[model samples]
Target: VALNQQPRDMIDLHARMFKKHGITTIRNFDALNDLRNLSYSGERIAEAGLHHQIVITIMDLPPGCEGAHTQEDYSKMLKDILDSDIPFHSVCFKDSSGTVHPRKVYETIQAARKMVPEDMILHLHTHDTAGIGISQYLAAIEAGITRIDLAMSPVSGGTAQPDILSMWHAMKGTDYTLDIDPLKYIKVEEVFEEAMGDYFIPPESRMVSPLIPFSPMPGGALTANTMMMRDTGTLHLYPKVIKEMEEVIRVGGFGTSVTPVSQFYFQQAYLNATQGRWEKINPQYGNMVLGYFGRTPAKPDPEIVKLASEQLDKPVFNEDPLDILEDGRPAAEKKLQENGLAVNDENVFIASSCESKGIDFLLGKAKENIRRKSTEAAKAEKIVAPTTVASADSVMGLREYTITVEGKAYQVQVAEGGGNPIVSTPVPAQKASAPAVAVKVVEAPTPGNILRLEVKAGDQVIANQTLLVMEAMKMESEVKAPAAGTVVDLHVSDGDTVQAGTPLLSLSS
Candidate 1:
């Protein structure tokens, strides 16, 4: 899969075979700013008696630096694509990695819908790769995406496919038809099992459902899990892919298959990682990593690449290219295999839940059954009927102690305090102490990971000056100084791990 390989070459590629098997309308996970050979491929498709639908979309933003500027740039790009008059049927903003902010998905879809007419599909494809695809899709639909694709639970990964049926049933806003018989779809497993004689699907890969607005069918022949298996040799590729993706985002470069959200997570992880440099990546590294995967990301302008090269260029790199194979180093292959998390099958459906997690839930059901059996056995033991105590105003009764209740613990306590000295009914305890000082003040407008740090500890920054850049779903976001002061306690630095509510940089009050 070299860049210069001809379309005829790709036709022999297994990916094309998947395409030939009733998967004609292949949508990219994300769109590249410069399609290396989309036109050529499209032409080849026509020659091959097939329609090649190449979706042209852009990931949202770079890692750092944000303004009305970045959005205006996206709007202009949309306009340019429209003016090109290329025979593209659709354009969309794909949140494939599920990294888009809910608000951004809403606004971006709304704005794009206004720019494109109904005939040219203005669509959105979000993946719950990071476990948030459903919410982001809901936001996009609310904003407007008439055409969408989802896996039936059988094919859906991470969780079930977007609950399309449930969402449709709940909102009633969309008027779309999948055109598949619901009853027939439900019977697919029986047919498949009959034909195959065995289920390839692990119990963990099975569908779990009704989590969202609507449920799509429980299964389908989709997902890139198989290629992910063949890619076992590219052990270092995952982290490298993450870093390269972030670098692309840093320079406004885009990919058709790698969504802005995916890039956001990749870049965000890269920016926060301890010690990897960009200069280290060369043609050899690219070949080992993305060269086999796809084109190395190119930028909006070559000048951006130059600027990035300046910041990232390092003299003494991590490892020598010649010694790459010799090093018994941090490799994804051994690591992933040791953990048994590396997926090694082409047909394996990565359900929305982890494959093993399904069995764990099943274990709960088994435990519940065991409890039922134990309770049934306990029915043989009877409690003595309560009797009045001889010559006393208060009466004490013997009660049966049954540990078996449905999946929960019994809380035994007397309503009165002090070791049940006085008999009384049990009561729930009042809540614990409240402390004002324990609460941390939240900086509004703070989004995902901090992308860049403009001001360091002890540096004086102005009230409105950018203190740091953060990113959520590939969109560049900013956090500015709250007040004019020398930075005091910089709790979190650039690339430091932090959650949404964690204190980033403490400013003097």
Candidate 2:
């Protein structure tokens, strides 16, 4: 949607590439549980001779919100996919948020087993975010699921798929058994740990979040959002953003808390906290509520629907999403030709799917900044102690102090004779000064990293025109010109981090 890419061409290109790369199976799913969205993709996957595992997304709605996301709702979804023209070799019950109860997992799979063919496979995938991975998996196995997704240690627990060893141990003393060695997984983990030792793992990615059920954030997206917040110096807003999501989900048609939709909820919640309640509706969220993404399981709240229609300046859409998008292959090829890049199937798909970054890459302007152990150590070594000497006449006994630099706090003890002290001069007091001039400046609405500056010095801008784009809590917001004026000076550049009320640019009326 960001690139306005056509679904048919993108899906066909990806399916052929997967088959060429020796991938035998692909798990296909839509976050909204819209079968119409998956029908064409599944057909293309089969055309490429790949086993397609059609997914039925599942999640538990927040307390006091109902009529959707229940087991019955999922069963109906399963029946729809079976009843549709989509071809698949297996069915997966996917709970991205890891909030579904064990009973629900068993019941959903049990109901699915009855509807699904005996020869076709039934798969289950979930995370351990809420400490329910084992129970949920066990329930699915008891319900006769054929396969479950597992991961190794370090990347295995807390905001990731459940660990192989944990499930292996859990299955012992039961009729079900895993065909694997626990010690082998231990050896594999050792290698993985050494390989990833330099990468900084956010603390939230390593612990169970008790509030997950209430917030219903996906494990896959949890750490990614936190890492971005950390970079923007807005990590403190994480809790507020998560808390605001409860209401976003309550009225967001209860689509399963998975990708695209999950991101929409998070983006909306973050905007509500940083940009005021519903003051800035995330375009993706607005599109979803307006029925651009396909029919949500339930109708979205009427008020929110109206708000989205007004803010996005789009009428409520009721047609299939794929029907509205134009064929993107020709546009992508034209973009490549315009940039003097070769147009091939791969290039067209990349340009269509990746947007501007893909164009930069094709032009050989993309920079590689992969993190390594030595780079991390270099960053730590860059922190230095204060070098400026305190004035001798300023204070007689100020020896201890606490200071924070670059997000790290330190305690320092100043000695009496470290460096040469400058002499102090006293000036006579002056009369009351006149009030300072009231300068007009555009300021950041919240602490965030500047994505780009839309205006330069001496550029004329109209009121409400975007001056820059800022990303805070993983949501992007435009910093608009407060009034029509000529841009006098810019205080920040691309990728600069700023706090709330920091002047982004000065404008002269």
Candidate 3:
């Protein structure tokens, strides 16, 4: 629906292609917001003779209601789908934020089982964001949910799904028993733990966070936003951003804070905190308010809608937004050809669906430029033989002395026969002087790969303008200008690895 150009034929093609690849099932969520699109996709999946599972993500917070419908509303929506002859194979309750209480899970599932057909399968998918996902799954199972999703120990917990081993242990000697070897899973856990190494987030840190119920930011977005704020030296303002997020969700109409919706809320909150409330609204948020994305779960505040409409200079679109888009396949093919790329149906489709630069990099048409410098020290070894050989008539004695210079030790040997003293060469030290003009060196704030350069040598820039973007610890950080100046030198290129305090560029007034 975001693309707005392709019709149901695209869905048909996708389903058939997946079926050709030996895929038998497809799962989806967020159908209420895009019921028309999802229903169309479901029809195509049914036509392709594949099983389709539609997941209803459940959240219980009052503030979260702005972004999602209530459990009863979700049940009604599910009934509508079941009655539509859409050939859905199952219905699932997904707790992406892991914020649903255990009791609520049991009650929600119990209610859903009554609404769903007895023959249809019921599944539960959840995360461990708040560290209660395993209990939630247990509740869901007791409520007649047959399928539950879990992850291995090393990859599970924290922001990820619950551990399969934990579930196995919990279900032991119960009616909901799992038939699996615990020892085999233990081996798998060991292998993955060793493989993940430094990337692993210890289980202890994945414990329940008290702030999640109030903030409701997904794990990935929260970490990314925190890193971004820290990199920009605005971490102190993060609390304000979180407060603004609640306001944004309320005024912007409650869209589920996941994926594109989550991103919209996060961006709007940042803007609201930094640029004043509603001073600058993102075009996507404006469109969302205008009903361009789809019918929001709740109507946006009239004042907010009016403000967005005035900014966009267009009224809210009640009809499907797909009606306004023109087919972009031809243009996509032309663009690929212009770039000297071989255009195929799939390639053109993908190119049209995503940003060109990102697609080019993913396709390896653009290469990453990185330079490696060795920092190893050179070592020299020397051997000296006696200057005079001992004879039968006379014996020569030698003495060895150790001398230290600049903390480095050296060994010297001398003959007792008054041989010239073994003397070492002395080098004069150079004096340091201050430069006439101070050069402002911009250094990296963290170790990361330079993702892109926003400025070049001789480019004039103002204070706080982003000079580059870097990726570190799986988050993108912007390197901004410290003061207004002309870029005198660039020491790193895109994809260069840099450490904290590594000089990246130089600027002069």
Candidate 4:
């Protein structure tokens, strides 16, 4: 379950619902850092008579010091919960980023097994992002971890959990065996592969990337960033962005690149590349630097911290960051009531936890708007041919007439025996080409939809100035002027589909 993304109240509500459905065990990923907030959640789960487990996400970066520091932190967090009368079933070492080396995984699991009680189960969860998930799992198993998380094929590799079939085969001759049939899983894989044929499935999502260990972008974030870049027509810059991310992660103290931290790193790196270095800092990054998200494995660069602090006025809270946030349920309930929506625990939870647009979609507001727009577009495109009235005379045999229909002149000839009428083809007028001049034609670098037009004809633009924005592969890219000149023509408009090398605009110096 997602602990970092939502509040304790929401989690409690979710736990109650899950318990109603007879779900006895719930594992919370990314749990160690949010202990204070999770304390109430744990109480609720225990109160509901449910088994709870917390997964401490680990990264083996920054080498020796961070591993030890994180292990200590995890030990303290586990001890705190166990001492608090909260009954937890197990603990997990989650290498969600797949950054942990196999040896490190073994060492960490070995240390953790000794630290926890003998009865307490140890679980291992790792992704195949760096293609070392199977090895890591093996290491964890050797270190006494019994429970391991694995996914089926199609959804099983790259950023996702390791493939269960692969692991099962590897363990076929071993004492630690899985009860399963390979054929059943292969059938499921085939169904998913067929179903996802139309969707954008990144190569990294299903294949090994040698660059992942160096880049260290989490699987989820990598997919998201790729789509974002594709939508912006800036997918070509992805490699550069990944390289920039390496430095960002390093300077930002190499915090486990997951969720809130991963997003922070991604946004900062994206802004650094697209705008300027540290020119646009996300507020969360500033909060992180100020110690709002708890302590980093390594301290952030003092220079970065100072710079971000100055920009954000350096608001630092010594205690848990959640202490500063006012409970949002009351406000959410009030807003729902004001909108004539039923003010219940579920609605309030959704309102408080979800974005306004998301709530509107859930309420069918967005869906209704889409249906209305579709209806309008359908009506606009409906073809309506002009109605014509004709009469034929046998004595005249045939007659020819010029008729005006729908403001267009049409020549029609009536012949004997209702023969088909022959119509003249209209010739479109063509204009002479402009005199040869030194002009620059800016073409689209990739296939995408024109998101916005920044300039129009007769407008003066400077070299490197953004001429327009295009979205491709789920990313946005800025189309810039090739040379300083007066805009002569625009070949594309907002929302127009374009192809690579398609002329977007023209300028004459």
Candidate 5:
């Protein structure tokens, strides 16, 4: 989905690149467990002389939510993989969310072992976000899983794969063995920590979240969502949004909570929380439920399907998603040529996937964004009240001035006769009051960064016409006019961050 060119071009490019980098194996899986989505890619990888590890995503749906991620669901996927005759050397039971129950993991792996050839490698990959990764891995090992993903400390143990040392320790005296040196791993951890000392590690990434099994968010997506919320000053809404995810997953057809799908669930949950429940449906969420991605494990709720159909203005589609997407190479090359860039495969792919930013990179217009720790400390400021204040010296009995320190500006306000500023009503200028006009102030429905303004001041718009676009939780939302009016004032501009109910613009009928 990140690539621009045709699927054929994208698959070929990636397969060749992975081989060039000495990668011998590629684990490929689709979020919806659609074999159709993985078939071509698997073939390409095998044709490229790389081992293809076809994957079936695994997760336990939030308790009381059902119809998918069952033993039958996994067996059906395995059967599909085998029946498709797609080239593969291994199979992976991957749970990015770390929400799979231990018994279910054991049963699935044991069952998979019996189905695949004896030589085929069976791998298990999961995170420790819910603090059950190690237990799940143990279950897999007992069920004859040959290989499992592991990480080292500092980066491990929280939202990452189970730490190698911890797993090694857990297997002590058991028939199974990790067979690695602890001293070497300690040194590795020390060096890794030193190398990463300058960067700020988000606290959420470092701590295990007990809520993962409940909401079932993947580790990578959880950190990403949290960081975006932190940047937009909406971190406080995270818990409420997470709580809202239960209903989204329960009703939205339980596709495995992995990327694209995971992000869709998260974005929808956020909207449901900030906006009224089901007030606004995320486009991707709407599309997924409408079967645009592929068949979800079970049928989605009919009410949600209807809501999505109406909101997205698209009918339900059940065909393979890959067959629906138009070939993008011709358009990509045309765009590259229009921009006077060489229409090579590399340029075409870049333009196709990266969109404008890719074009900017080709044209040398891309700006570098690098974050580094600041070395200089900010200096403190001391504020002192005036010894004697005159009533006429201040504007409306209040004083305002800006102070600059270390290249940063700080606005300061001083009140006259300030032991504590006394409340006083300001006198109005000696002028007649203006006539009252019917004006409507349009406020933001949720916190987001303003993407663009569709209607500027004095622009006449009809009711329900889009007035501005907002980016929230990595999704673009159109803010429409509530009624017909002329936009009289804009309180915000493009790229300004706004909170829920913050005034965005004013309209006069």
Candidate 6:
């Protein structure tokens, strides 16, 4: 959380003084990147026994806007802030620029919710310039925000939120489990109304979040997410951005980020769109952090906007980028082209998707699609092909199997032929096994040794459908299917090496 906002000398002075006085301070860090500097600040915070707070600042777009707050820049900033460890007790998304859209705000908060844990408090502070601030507040509530910063006076043209009455009413609409009472709120507001007559009170705004009914976005405590997405104009590729996030989480990773890293993720889309190149990730340090920002789009009804605007005595603006050209004034793509990042015949760069995902996934997808295409194709390529169909049927007990793995090949010795099975090879037991009550086949979870076959070919199995287990990572993961399928063949015996993306066992359907 040690920041590099002001001059390094000033920070050094503070650090020295803080240490000398034995103060338990919270280091407020600006740049969450810059490892050498971040490390130094982290060391200082640790030595002082202070909690570090991070507030990642978004990069101003090359061209400045009078008051536009860019969500993309905020996203990048938040991404970078969470990417590094600074003993950050809390993170705040500050709207240094007053321009922010309601929809973008909703999406940004949701994305932030996913980036941080419940224990980590997220905060937001914004200057209202196009009047979407109240909408942003409502979006925060729906997006599961708990903490916010409001000023006593209206900032810029609009006011700081949580106007006692408005916040109290909004809380009533929310199912949030905050311990409180609205009657106390009404009593306080009555006293304030008498003391400060005609004090400005903006009405409660509509939700600014995108409608993600199936899987709701998480954190809304900050505007860093909103600023990050909007700043980058990432609202355009909203779905893809969220998709990358889900995939990252699936791989046991989180999408907490920093500004520079956020820029890296969307650089091709913005700065170098025509170049078609992505930034390289180095695992030595940043692998554990960085990448991906998302949000639920805000959908505030115009009639509602009109109602709120009239109440606040201010004009409420639409936050959707599509509206930029709603009257055919200018399209976002056209704006990009105007900015000189558009693709032309000259600036084209070579790119392909297969490089990162590998040919296997693509081929697997194509195979499934082709099989599903037509009955003729499906007849030729089965969804789950039986060993009899995929290969010539081998004898039940006597089958010679050789497994090639990695680059080294292993010769597997299998037991063969009834009474001859006992002393010839590995000791093999011969039994009738309940007349094939259930012919369950076991396959490898990942490519590894066969280890041990818990059940024989003709053994009865319950509905749970477990046959064999494989060892991967550090623990033993199970490989199970249904109990009804016929056990056609066991490819390898115990203690045989295998490769990933390799099929080890075949079950008859």
Question: What are the root-mean-square deviations of the candidates from the true structure over C-alphas?
Answer: 21.4, 9.5, 16.3, 15.2, 9.5, 25.6
Q: Estimate, for each residue in 1-509, the C-alpha lDDT of model 4 and write its tens digit.
A: 23124555666777787797789987765412546655666677777878888667677553323333355665665666667665567887767678788887887788788878888899987788888998888888888897998987667878898888898877765668778888898898899877755555666578776676776767777776665554445678777767677767777766777765776776677667766787756556677777776666567788888888887676655576555556666777776877678877667666665535335645766322122322433433211111121221111245556566666555566676777866743322354434656667676654456766889989999988989976543334577876799887776676676645566777888
- TM-score of every prediction relative to native: 0.40, 0.79, 0.68, 0.68, 0.77, 0.32
TM-score quality measure for candidate 3: 0.68
True-structure lDDT of candidate 4: 0.67
Please give the lDDT score for candidate 5: 0.80
lDDT of each: 0.41, 0.79, 0.67, 0.67, 0.80, 0.39
1-509 per-residue lDDT for model 5 (tens digits): 36111366666767876787699989888888988888888999999999999999988888787788998789889998998979999999889999999999999999989998898899999999999999999999999999999997678877899999899988987799977889998899999988877665677987888888889999988987886676566789999999999999989989999877888898889888987899988777898999988888888999999999998789999887777677668878888988899987677777776665577789997644233344212312121111222222233336655455666555456676665744433333455545656777777765666766888888999998989977655445678887898888777777677766667777777
Best by TM-score: 2
Cα lDDT tens digits, model 2, 1-509, are 23232577788898997898799999998888888888998999999999999999988877777868888888988888888888898998889999999999999999999998887899999988998999999999999899998888788888998889999999988899889877888899999998889876667987898889999999877876776666555789999999998999988888888876887888788889877898877777898999998989889999999999998789999988998777788889998999999988878877887655577788887534355655644653111111222321123223445455665545455557775433333222343434543447666655556766888988989988989977654455677876788887777777676655566777777
Better of 1 and 6 by TM-score: 1
- What TM-score does structure 6 among the candidates reach? 0.32
Clashing pairs in 2: none
lDDT per residue, candidate 6, 1-509, as tens digits? 11002223333444555666666645353322223345445555655556665554321221221222256546665676567554557776544333345566667777787878887777765533324455566777687565765433222123234343444445566675345565775576566646544432222111233321111122221132333333223334445543343222222121222322332222212222221212222111122222111111122233433443443344433232222222211232343354354432111110011111112233242112121122432342112211221332454344545455655444454544344532223222343223322333343323233444656654545544656654432123345654455556666565454433234555655
Q: Model 3: per-residue lDDT, tens digit, 95-183?
A: 66677789878888888889877877999887777778888988888898978988886667777788889989888767887778989
Our tally of clashes for model 2 stands at: 0
Model 1 reaches what TM-score against the true structure?
Answer: 0.40
Flag regions of model 4 displaced more than 4 Å: 1-11, 20-23, 31-34, 62-86, 366-509
Candidate 4: count of backbone clashes, pairs at least 3 residues apart or interchain: 16
In candidate 3, stretches whose alpha carbon ends up further than 4 angstroms from where it belongs are 1-13, 62-68, 172-174, 198-207, 223-238, 365-509
Q: Rank the candidates by TM-score, best first.
A: 2, 5, 3, 4, 1, 6
* Alpha-carbon deviation at 488 in model 1, angstroms: 59
